[model samples]
Target: MEGIIARRVIPSDNSCLFNAVGYVMDHDKTKAPELRQVIAATVASDPAKYSQAFLGKINEEYCAWILDSEKWGGAIELAILADYYEREIAAYDIQTTRCDLYGQDRKYAERVMLIYDGLHYDALVMSPFEGAPEEFDQTIFAVQKDRTIGAVESLALNFARDQQRKRSFTDTANFTLRCGVCQIGVVGQKEAVEHAQATGHVNFQEYR
Candidate 1:
């Protein structure tokens, strides 16, 4: 573990390892050099043994500390890796559109909404979207506005996943209210309706 720790001639700051560790040696008394060596070796060998070693880490300086931790490389490495992966995923997803995935004809959207008859009064929960937020919100307001129902329940916004087994890509959608009463409706990117159906949700329409 010798030279595994990098030390430079730097002044001590609050966050620095030096200012945080300084000992006043008694000039009259002699201490064993082996004791100091043993302690240093133990700390370098494995860091998990020291609980106080990672305290004050949740502060704003945490990101910097995490990047500098001996077990891992610096934040610059992680940042580079993150950006690379993000660009790759974005490029791949760009070529695959929801319309192309769920089929240009959204014959399945109506059937997806029917599964929610039981959850009508609960919430019109929706996921976030790139383009469908305003449209979905307007649709929710349209379905629930000026009616004898709870105020338009706001659904969470989320990205649509291209579920393969169910084979539905829900990026843009409209859910009709049962009996045309409440306007509050949820728009999921793609319904895991098959999972729901397996639990005896009782499918009313065939998947065309």
Candidate 2:
């Protein structure tokens, strides 16, 4: 019998992406620091590849930024880690119910699934039964198993749809935020980034 696909929630620290990837790849959640170091080293070693034009920051600045434990990881981090690990990382978005496959063109030997709820990431696992303990979770799938991949992809979409109905994602484009440092009101992610850049205030809380 086929198993049920479910989200394995990772802690909401700034390193949720790293933690999610770590959990799926090694069943270990404490690899964030090591993974951050790996990304920094990779970018630093290949400045020609990870250029400022590509990273939106100078290569050395990006490496230093990524090394910070409080800095969040996104597409750039995902691509680097996927290439380093030599496995495809399929991220299913709850807001859009779309799967974004990293390293898809690499013909990797294996793949892992992660659930993204706008700002946070969680690992996707196959459980032997509904409500099963995470200890019974299966996080890796063979890239060659077409049947398994199809089933998991369908299940991941269904899961994302359910989460969508619950409004489990932040609408970064329209969400409101309040700066914790200056108590300034900010609208959406763009304004929040601008506020941070202008005032060097990175603390923000969502406000309904």
Candidate number of the best TM-score:
2
Q: lDDT per residue, candidate 2, 1-208, as tens digits?
A: 3888888989988899999999999998889999999999999999899999999999999989998988999998998889989999999898898888898888888889999988899999899998998888899888764523656777878988999999999999999999999899988899999999999998899999
Query: Mind giving the per-residue lDDT tens digits that candidate 1 earns over 1-208?
Result: 0111111111211112211111111111122232223333443444454234443343234343433322122222212222222210000121122211111122112100001111110112222333343223211112223221122111111112222223332232332222112222333312324333444332222221
Q: Model 2: how far is 2 from its true place, Å?
A: 2.8
lDDT computed for candidate 1: 0.22
* Runs with alpha carbons beyond 4 Å of true place in candidate 1: 1-87, 90-165, 175-183, 186-208
In candidate 2, the residue pairs with backbone N, CA or C atoms under 3 Å apart (3 or more residues apart, or in different chains) clash, namely none
Q: How well does each candidate superpose onto the true structure, as a TM-score?
A: 0.14, 0.94
Misplaced by over 4 Å in model 2 are 145-148
Instruction: Pick out the ten consecutive residues of candidate 2 with the lowest summed lDDT.
Output: 144-153
